[model samples]
Target: MKPNDLSTSSFIGWTCKLLAILIIVSLVVDCSSKKDVYYCPMHPHYTSDRPGNCPICNMDLVKKEDTSEHKDHSNASNSLQAAESISNEDHSSHLSETSSEKNSRELILSFEKQQSIGIKTELVSKRNLVKKISAYSSVAYDPELYSALSEYKEAVRSSEFLSPEIIRNLQLRLRQLGLSLDQIRIWTSGARDPSELILGGKSGRAHIYSQIYESDFTTVKVGLPIKFKTDVYPEKEFIGKIKSIDVILDKNNRTLRLRSEVSDPSQLLKPQMFGDTVIQVSLPNVLSVPTSAILDTGKQKIAYVQTAPDKFQAVSVQTGKNIEPWVEVLSGVQENQRVVTESTFLIDSEAKIRFGSDSHAH
Candidate 1:
């Protein structure tokens, strides 16, 4: 219509368009604030309603992914990263599902991973654990046997001056001094008279002398089994029994010299023949674990006990009487419980890195 009317219409239309744009902008801002939540990718523990820097990591916060998918990835990432940290300060405390389970160093290993890493397990059972004492021994003569030989000579000579009764009594003394009945018969048959009588100086059997430490002295007992090995015959094993133990201990090493009687029918073992002796003293039935199951971190010895089918808890255990393949458990483990036998070092490394906390913390 008129020029002023046209200007008024144009101003009204421009105002309406500007108001619509502002309203649309306000709606988009409100929707983004309510629907989209941002979180720190580096520090997954830090989350925000909108984009900002992470308080812990100081990194820019990013848009959080789908809740279910993110939770799954976070759990897996935490388990793997639990063993990969080097700092003394833990960056994963916020990821723990429960504070009580923290510092337990639990690991959830899949069946496939357990098989691939050679992780094995065994039951803690009550069994006889032997304390093996290994030491160098020499084939020596028993001092009493030598005195017996001297007594035999004296008795044979004394018989010339005495009656037949005294000679028979002296011959019987030889039998009490470890001489066999056959040996005494041979002595009497060889000599025509008492002066011609000759007694064997050396005993046919071998006397093995081994030094036992003070720690193992109490466990060592008479009739305990011992096996001997010589350089001359490496494959041949000479089994013996502990015959005697010295009352006095060694001044330098604080050890006891024990004797074992070994039968040498072939006379392959001679006096002063050096040999290595292994004295096996069996202990009473106690809870024991496999040697491969335990991991020692200098101060603390650790073992992973399977708490669940796929979960394991790193437990500290007291060890005693460690043999080649088995070790006695003093405490920290119960009877019939399962313990990890292999891949312990790997589990230990993971535990320390995580500060013995939940491996799958999220």
Candidate 2:
């Protein structure tokens, strides 16, 4: 137990401890090097000394690439960073191309929409210039016959020679002779009742005479032709000539009559048949269009001028004398222009609705 001996023992113990630690480290290194013998490139942390699959990821561990000649860690890091930056640039370029394509598509759609709007606007502007007029008229009968009946009755009572009983007996005798009592009474009353005013009373039994427009006499030139179609035989057209035109107007009816003789002279063309009369004023040839082309709305007369397929513009026009399927256009129309004949109502309504909506938007 001397001090020097103690110091020497301490130094020996320290040497043994150092040698034991060195031996243990060498054994551990040898064992680790021989363990699994494998490595993974994707998971650089995996380093097995023996051939085997990576425990962290199910991949066959491959031998680590030899990089001992370029062992600088800083150089490896720089190469990886450069590759990552190039990949990012490529992705950015792809994104830019996609955005440009989308922008181009959007521009094309907008252009198409604008063109559609322009077309609609043009159509509306063209359709607003037409005028339309519509009117309604009814067939009327002569009123003077009724007025004359009243005057005739007053005259009969004023005569004082024939009593009411005598008038009744005369009416009864007329009825027995196949004449109506009303007819006799009307005649005795001095009323110019067209139905009661029979010709050749008791003399010409089969013949019946009727009065017509008296003022039309001037037009009743010899051999002048007249055509008429009675409602009784609507299908049959009767051709006639003016036999006589009375110069005197019927005071009650205020209308003159023309007596016409028909070629057939059939009983079908009887007096009191209601129908339309067409008088040819003997005018020269005139330009006209089909009456179907005109759309009448009382206030104005409108016609559709076809501009394109399913496209039309309403035009205001003045018209005169309508003949079946044809009418005389006085103004505001042109020749050879296509006009809407069918489906006019649909076209007119669509045009108006479109125009109204457009105006509201504006």
Candidate 3:
């Protein structure tokens, strides 16, 4: 053989050997890829047939360590079956939770529907609301007060002939009849008689006889503003100050008798003039809503709160004193929220039908 022919044979042999090594490497890679199942550890539900990144978590797929080759075939089959059953159960539970959560947080009403239902809303306010307690009363002269004044005056006049002990006892008695030291001292020095005190004193004032219920007795105190309106004088509002509250309860009515002194400048509030009294009690700034916003189902007091422009949610609130058109909101709403004021009953009816949470029906 020539030298060129030998060199050609050597080149062909090296090429064949290189091709054989490449074929073995390709087979090994194919087998390894077939055994490997790639999955994202961050998203356990995601798996890929080939090694790739997870679509959801954007994390690199991790190769699951293969136990099928080392374990019994029957055991591998049983494990696969168990995993499938658990996965189905988990998927169903996840779907149920998603549906329930969606319903719980949302209640969508169209703007047109809201207008048709005559819905009206007002922003919850944190301001002073004068909690008013009401009671029907009659104006009358204070006889007991005048009688004590007379006895006190008589004791004072006879003090020159009477003992010092008698004078001290008389002073104590005047105090017991609800007279302050200033009142008795002023009465003694002044020229007003007992008859003038009974009918109409120099001030031409009268006392209002009222009953404060057990619930109101504790909250009411002297010096609170009082307003009285009689049927005869409809427009006139007689303002007064609470003078005294009886220590003993009225046995017949089971209420506390409260006496308020009203100066009758117009003399409209005369003796035996029947009137309704409203006591304005000042309270600290608290959360409040309109009285029309509340809907009581006997057991629960609910108010419709506007979570969105058209969507309203029914929330149970703890209520306190009522001041005419407004009421104290103790809880279940914030000061900045908007509450449905007018047509609240209609909103509540619809909400109950839609949400089906009328635990207290009838």
Candidate 1 lDDT over 304-352, as tens digits, reads 8999888888777898777667888998889988999988887666655
Every model's TM-score: 0.52, 0.33, 0.58
Model 2, TM vs. native: 0.33
TM-score of 1: 0.52
Residue-level lDDT of model 3, residues 1-362, one tens digit each, is 99999999999999999999999999988877756678999998888778989999789999886676656766888899999989999998998997665455345689898889898899888887667799878876667777777777888888899999988888887766555676567668764455544565236566787778877887799888898889998988888888767666667878887777777865555666788899988877867888898888888898878888867777789888777678888898898999889888887777667767752232
Error of 2 at 140 (Å): 21
Please give the lDDT score for candidate 2.
0.51
> What's the C-alpha lDDT at position 64 in model 2?
58
Whose TM-score is greatest here?
3
Off by over 4 Å in 2: 1-224, 227-239, 244-256, 263-284, 308-310, 357-362
Q: Write the candidate numbers in order of decreasing lDDT.
A: 3, 1, 2
Q: Which residue pairs clash within candidate 3?
A: none
